[model samples]
Target: MDRTTDTTALPLIPRAALFGNPRRAGAQISPDGGTIAFLAPRNGVMNLFVAPRGRIDAARPLTDERRRGIPGYAWAHDGRHLLVVKDNDGDENFHLHAVDRETGAMRDLTPHGPIQASIVKLSPRHPGEAVVSHNARDPQWPDLYRIEIATGRSTMIAENPGLAGFDVDEDFALRLAARLEGDGSQTVLRPDGAGGWAPFMRFAPEDAMTSGVLGLFTADGRATLMLSSAGRDTAALFRLDLETGEATMLAEDARADIGEIIVRLHENTPLAYGVNYERNRYVALDPAIQPDLDALDAAGIGDWGIQSRSEDDRFWIVGAASDTAPGVAWLYDRKTRALEKLYDTRPDLADAPLAPMRPVVIAARDGLSLVSYLTLPADGGSAPRPLVLLVHGGPWARDSFGFNPYHQWLANRGYAVLSVNFRASTGFGKAFLNAGDREWGRAMDDDLLDAVDWAIGQGIADPSRIAIMGGSYGGYATLAAMTRNPERYACGVDIVGPSNLETLLATIPPYWEAGRSIFTRALGDPATPEGAALLRERSPVHQAARLARPLLISQGANDPRVKQAESDQMVAALKAKGIAVTYVLFPDEGHGFARPENSIAFNAITEHFLAAHLGGRAEALAAEEIGRSTAQLLEGAEILP
Candidate 1:
């Protein structure tokens, strides 16, 4: 294994090749195992393409969506219709659409206006029905409804009873619900059989996000697979008996928590559970699936992403991807033990010089382990090169090793890329996650700073030339880095980052009402005097006058989570303080840039901005590029080359 960083000159991979939409993606097998459906462009917009199983060339467009392509769709139990989720102008108010495969007719099941919806349970027992959660009645919390796919009729099954979220069993029975206490703790409830709810489990504020029910057992609906770090250092998987409240450990990882579980859809039993340390590794619980896992491991195609399998379990659709390679979809014949390639997401990158991502564990200032991934450039000598501290959003999310175009773009432009999993990041343990509580701008920002110091200490990053960039919570981190430690970074890029904690909490979308306790726990409640004072102290908008470095901020005008007002006030504050800042706004985007043209346009400007401040290579943006995008230059136009 070559851990040495590449320093030789290589061909420049085009920005379009890296950032452009894939030719085809999200290929899946229908439930009945007779047909296959994938997402491909139709009249330049992404739409569903259906074909017979095992035949990729014969795929045809099933749905014709003109404005924004269908982002995701799933096969219904009957195999007669496809359940599709879509949003308008990136507002993220998802609507459930059922497309009749034979007639290609689409019906909006939940036609309610501007509300978030998600598929809760799709049971094989009820072929014509699905349990979905919609935030129609209340803007903040989602209420459960049983929707009939055939007639588009919806009936309220169990209205959300002020819990943050709910989990259902295979029988579509409400098994678990989590309620956030005022003290930042979480109480898990189960049906008491007397038509009321009984407390099943409880989690302290520090263990709130770390411990929760994964799902109820499909076998009996009386047992649940849960993750808890109550008396441990890391969150581990356990099977809990609903009747006795006794838990038995199923799996435990010293360094990481259980990331995902692969369950047998029909039986509702977990087949394998995955632990994501540096990369993802799966543990097979059922011996029958071990041979398939062995076959996949022997193939060495790349990290496997199993998409779907036939109802009879004969054929499987999987995707293989790596940090350097885009992704190659495959179809595996389980009976024959054969693997066939479907399509390479980006064949242009087949022979391109993409940087390799290396996982390293660094220590924070407080000696806590900080898991991180780093990518270095492939051009010439490396004498402490300029570094791009790429922070992931989801103050709750952790960065993993994968095919990241942003990392490749930065590395190709002659900058070292480092993504750190700060204290509050998930997949670690309750202790690490709790460390981030009420320490958003304090300890969370410290972990990033410590990462920079470690990078410089290892001679992989130049101490004098480093830039911080991220989106969502990452975007908030970018602003915090610039305002809190102005002399540390040469520049910063924040995409859709909340500027004011107080305003951000105040304006959170209604559907997030259930999770308000988590928010109040992480960042103090702005409604209270102490919480309000803390939020004000951590808000970047109030500290904008302290910025001494150039900053590039991007936002989707229709972002529902972090409203456009966040960027507006941040930019206004920077302008009032006479600070140099570049702001880009996309009218048709939400949270992040989704459309290809907007993504390319933003990257074009971002490249130029990074180059101007950090002396990195930047692809020149042509006039035609800007003409094709809907991006508006809010301010700092001079930063564009």
Candidate 2:
């Protein structure tokens, strides 16, 4: 358990610079390529802004969103407006809005109260119209509606018949639908030509998440694109013949699923596809775009993605970033083979001593190959520094090699940061994902322990000064690690994580009823006695008495998936045992902290807590920092510096 290190100093990166809103991000080109739009901070809140193409200096804000910033936006096909989606304080009841570029007027396209609405399809054929989905009729199922973007008039095109989701063509025609069965399997259905739906394909429960219809790819409505892992180890891209029921394989990887597909705008024709293992490997499906991909690869600026393209595909807004650098947006001219840098997402980090993330494969005790990323302090000599195990949420999601802010911030604070893609993480093959079924606190926790052993064995971490931190499932993992093996970690941070599986299952949002079976099957069903007992046994709340290290818990008041009760129950149990656990709550937040101020405030408390226990350097919390956020310290304020 060596803790000695050569303390070659590195500048402490400010929490604001690392966690604050980006200078400019989500850049996209207008349909005619006459203007560029991106999300930038307007009065400390991210708002939609647009500028004439190549004239970022002339940018003007189109929307004045003061509270929770706009999450994402896209240019309308008509080129007259921009489409944006917003939710209230991370409640996730998203509402679609259209911003008129000329008048600077924002109109809520779907103003239904407390309903989750999203744009389903926007077509150039119907330039002023968009197909949207909302659960106004029934909270459990969202119905489809065609809406006039300018006037916000709507017409119900199709009603949900207990379908999970629907797919539409560029012509604004609903062609395919997917239904999640009670057994956790998925069935793809097609229109029967007489107002009824006929089953097109069926997938087992294991392939439910990996397999689905992507979109109708054929102009004749006879074929569609799909990603399916049935009869294969990994999910692969395929063109499915709707009439013949045959699938033509397009691209695939043995190690990873097809994660991204680049297609021609409005045409549904795929140009390239990408699969991610340790890093992303993009393959050009159409040879015409090979040169563009080649040029981007040759640029040596990390992984690049085509963010937006002109109508004629002559101009592309490309975003590139790596593990050590913040993202840079570039305007790529396809005709001239030139890449002009637009702006850095975070100019403050351009000169920061950010650590490089190295992807490593660790063997679980059961011999499962766990893909993990490690980032050590830039100038802290290789003498086994204190380590932080940062787990990703989703337990269904994964930790890929990228410019992760948490990694940089923690590394700058003088701790080695490691993120592990343990069992149940997506993007890997189905066998690896299905292997984690109902293994929440048992096998899943073991994989983390094995990763710790590997880090310590490699002289990368001091065995005694390790901490676990994460949100959602990662938060659950942090709590599980602290309680199951209290001797391993020095401290733990849990953000919006569920403590009791039974309560978590019972409190899921009504809109998530479609996928409830998937959760029950993957994490044990609470309705059955045997399953309920298993859930109770695996829940960290049941093992709270075993906790022996410092713990920090943060929660959003309105988390629909993992409700606030989960955190409240765990804190109550710990307090009942006279254990001192720090609790921070954001009344405005839901699943996680969406506001940068709230994030910074929580991290401010977290760093001090870690510093006290793990001997890591921390930036002292400023009074103004917490004043700007809605974070309420409900407990353990004494731990703050």
Candidate topping TM-score: 2
TM-score of each: 0.96, 0.98
Query: Please, what is the whole-model Cα lDDT of each candidate in the order they appear?
Result: 0.87, 0.90
Residue 471 Cα positional deviation in candidate 1, in Å, after optimal superposition: 0.3
Candidate 1 displacement at residue 507 in angstroms = 0.6
Worst 10 residues of 1 by lDDT: 1-10
lDDT of 2: 0.90
Count of backbone clashes, every candidate in sequence: 5, 0
Which pairs of residues collide in model 1?
7-380, 139-510, 139-511, 140-510, 140-511
In angstroms, the error of model 1 at 289 is 1.7
Per-residue lDDT tens digits for candidate 1, residues 1-641, read 22223443666678998887788899889887778888987887789889886678988888888866889899999899999988988998999999999888999999999888999888787888999999899877688899999999999877776878778876777788889888878898988888667898898777777888876575756677888888887888888888899989988899888877877766656788889888998899889889988999889888986898888888899888988888889999989889988888888788888889999999998999999999988664668888999999989999999899999988988889999999999888778888898998889999999999999999998887899999999999999989999999989999999999999998888777778878988899887899899999999999999999899999999999999999999999999988878999999999898888898999999998888788887777888777888999989889776
Our tally of clashes for model 1 stands at 5
- Residue 218 C-alpha lDDT in model 1: 52
In angstroms, the error of model 2 at 157 is 1.3
